[model samples]
Target: MSGARGAWWARIPEPVLDAVVVVVAVVDVLINLDDTSGPAWAMATLACAALIVRRRFPLPVFLLTLPASLMLDIVFAPFAALFTLSERSRDRRLLVTCALLFAVASATPWPLDDLSSHERAWTLVYFFYTLATAAAPVLLGQLVQARRDLARRLVEIEEAREHERLLHSQAVLARERAQLAREMHDVVSHQVSLIAVQAGALQVAAKDPDFREGARTIRSLSVDTLDELRHMVTLLRASGGRSTELTPQPTLADLHKLVTTSGIDAELTGELPPDVSSTAQRTIYRTVQEALTNVRKHAPGATATAHLWHDGDAFGVTVTNTPPARPSLPLPGSRQGLIGLKERAELLDGTFASGPTGDGGYEVRLRIPNRAG
Candidate 1:
């Protein structure tokens, strides 16, 4: 539609359009008049002036030149309909317009004085040559625009693909965070419940010094465990407990109380890595603690061993115990302690496996990578 409007203005026949196209062409030749003169100069002016209507009524302007040029003969200009076919449009319009332009060009200079009678007999030959030459520049411009449009579309497709990838990544992160929160809730609640049960038992059995000492140990473990649980909650709320009230995090050194409170014979075989920060140590401690709790509940008579080793890149831990002599006792309720331990190991870029070991024993192994907290 815009192309049609521009073409209509070009062929408006207003004094301004006529004067600009005609005067410009004449001035162009006058500036280089020494190089060419006569028929060529007048024809150049007519071609320039006729082009004002080339985009709007291309076929009509080309036809108009035929009668007007026949009257003036040597002074007529060649018609160029090249501009009409340059824009993106239907093929039918281009074919009709080009045919009309060729007809006008063929009839205008009939019976050329410079050619032999045999050559002049076929005027259509010269008409086709002129049509091809005039259309060359417009065809080149259209090809360039087509290539540019294809490049723009390719860039748009790449950007849309990148946006979808980012959306998928955000959704996965949200799901993992929710799963981690659920695991933490189960682990902390299980530990607190066990501490409460032990405290109640000690209250009735305190006549013995061993029972009195066990009661004190339970008090200490409960306090320390609550502090770690609070720290975990703070981490869930934000990045860490920076702005919240939090007790100091536990390390491998704190595993002593954890084993003591459980009232089990736990033989420690290897040393823990001293170089790693508090977080990794705490994670290892919690994993061992959870594995021991499982042993106590499911295999009460089994003797347990806690092993910790450092092999340069990671801290390796193993908690293993023998089978129970009697039927396994059921705790108050089943809890997700092992699931939380796995989550804690993964958060630190670690690997974990827990199940029955060969030789009728159960074992849990964790390998936590040594990275800066």
Candidate 2:
């Protein structure tokens, strides 16, 4: 019971176990001694006393006290020593040596005389008994060691799975944060565009040429500010694909314009649904624009491709790019553009996805319902 490991309650304290060994040795010495041989009993008792440290220095205690067995046959100390040695290292050499010593000593005819020398049959019988006695501790030690190994491996696997779960949780949190950024833009960006359009109207209405020029300047500044805000929102969203394509430089229906104007080498194909709402069209436009921007930032000279089409209940935009044409700029990217695109599509009850292609390139795709309603 004391030998079972991996749980605290199964153990016996070392000092108590040592005390038990000492008491047993004393009793053994008392029982085996002849009534006239007080001095010999005292000497044998001293040798067996070494069992008190049998678990600590098992081999040393076993070897030093083995002679005590020659006088009265002390079994506990040697058995405990053998068990401890096998438990610690599973060393074959030490186990075999201890077993051989026990076998030889157990078979030896004591108080040497000619009658004892002739008892070969008795010697063989005692040898087998001692060998089996030596084997019991070894088998038990191996069992305990095996159990301990299994427990350790199970603990490691659990920890590894816990680490993976934490990583997955962090990834989800990042996506939610990106979605929040896109929502913020949705709330504020439209007002800014309205202000820019009003400034342009003011420029056209002014009669004095100098006053008209001032209004024109104001309008220009407002437009520029709106563009910058959109850029910032796109970067924060990580879903922003191409900022350039998204900003309505061309009509939303023209997918070819998005691929051509983004400055990345790329191709465009497919037709848009004629009845698509302006809202759905804008979402697809921003998606393609963000994809192109991502290609420019991450892939540099890589060729890009765009496919715009209508999928039954939804309008789809797919943008893909070849691997980078040149070494990347050392600058880090915000990835807001991609996130913003994803947020835009989802808000319209659509889907968005992006990943690497098999040939080391990248792809981004978005789908939105044909009508904002």
Candidate 3:
């Protein structure tokens, strides 16, 4: 019922509530004027006016109402001011000071009365009653303030979560845009490169001056198109503001040199056929490079073992690295290399597998069928 009353009061607009305070104070003064003298009546009237601005200046208004309450039979003016001051006060000094003053005023007898020394027990009971009355309203005010603060905090948290969700959505859209640009580049670049090669063949085979000149023009146009396509791809990649290494593509023959120069302790077992196609060689080369790179990145200063063999109709390659012993500058990667490698192997109707070993190391395996030219 207290909660329901508080909620109902909370819905009351501030200006209307302030007006209600003035009306109530005026009524109190009118009803209790007969019990007080002329000076007390005048003070109570002024306090009733002060109640109009009690919320804006609670402490000052409470001071006005305190005197009026002491000298007159008006109860609501002082109690209302007490509740407002306690509810709105941010300073500890104000709350404590106002509380003590109200307790003292409530405990004291305003009208002179003859009482004997035997009424000491009655004094104690009156003191306890006054103290409890002073405390109860202040506690209620504190509870109301706490509820308001909690509501504000909940609203702020919800707004923050909504902002985070918006940012995540933007990030997802950007990644999809980059992926689409990449697909366009790969497909377009490969076809243009083939056209350039065919044009070069035409230039070499033509005999007539006119035909040779036409072939030369076609070759030049195709080469220029391929270059433009490469530039577009570079721009797309750089749009994300991520750093990229500007190095030449690695191949199978560069494996030995890579392992040696990178200062990585690795053992290569079995051998690759010397007469393999460039496509096959490039796939094998990049797979080895990516595997070794992961080893150096995740487990620096650890020993890695690689095994490559031609098994009947398919070629199998496996690379495994142990955990690092001595920690070094850890490298960062998105593990996108493994994802690309899986796609690469699948395109060639091959198999790719990678995971942790039994000894807490990492392993990657690839099996390529020999059926492709």
- Residue lDDT tens for model 3, 154-215: 54445546755875676565566567568867788888878888888988999998998998
Residue 200 local lDDT, model 2: 85
lDDT of 2: 0.70
TM-score of each: 0.35, 0.48, 0.54
| lDDT score at residue 49, model 2, on the 0-100 scale | 73
Q: What TM-score should be assigned to candidate 1?
A: 0.35
Which of candidates 1 and 2 reaches a greater TM-score? 2
**Candidate 3 at residue 47, lDDT?**
86
Q: Pick the candidate with the highest lDDT.
A: 3
lDDT pick, better of 1 and 2: 2
For model 1, residues 275-317, the per-residue Cα lDDT tens digits are: 7777788788788878886776666567899888877777768
Model 1 residue runs over 4 Å out of place are: 1-85, 88-96, 99-103, 110-120, 185-189, 192-373
Task: Say which prediction, candidate 2 or candidate 3, comes out ahead on TM-score.
Answer: 3
Scanning candidate 1 in windows of ten residues, the lowest lDDT window is 239-248
Highest TM-score, which number? 3
Q: Please, what is the whole-model Cα lDDT of each candidate in the order they appear?
A: 0.62, 0.70, 0.73
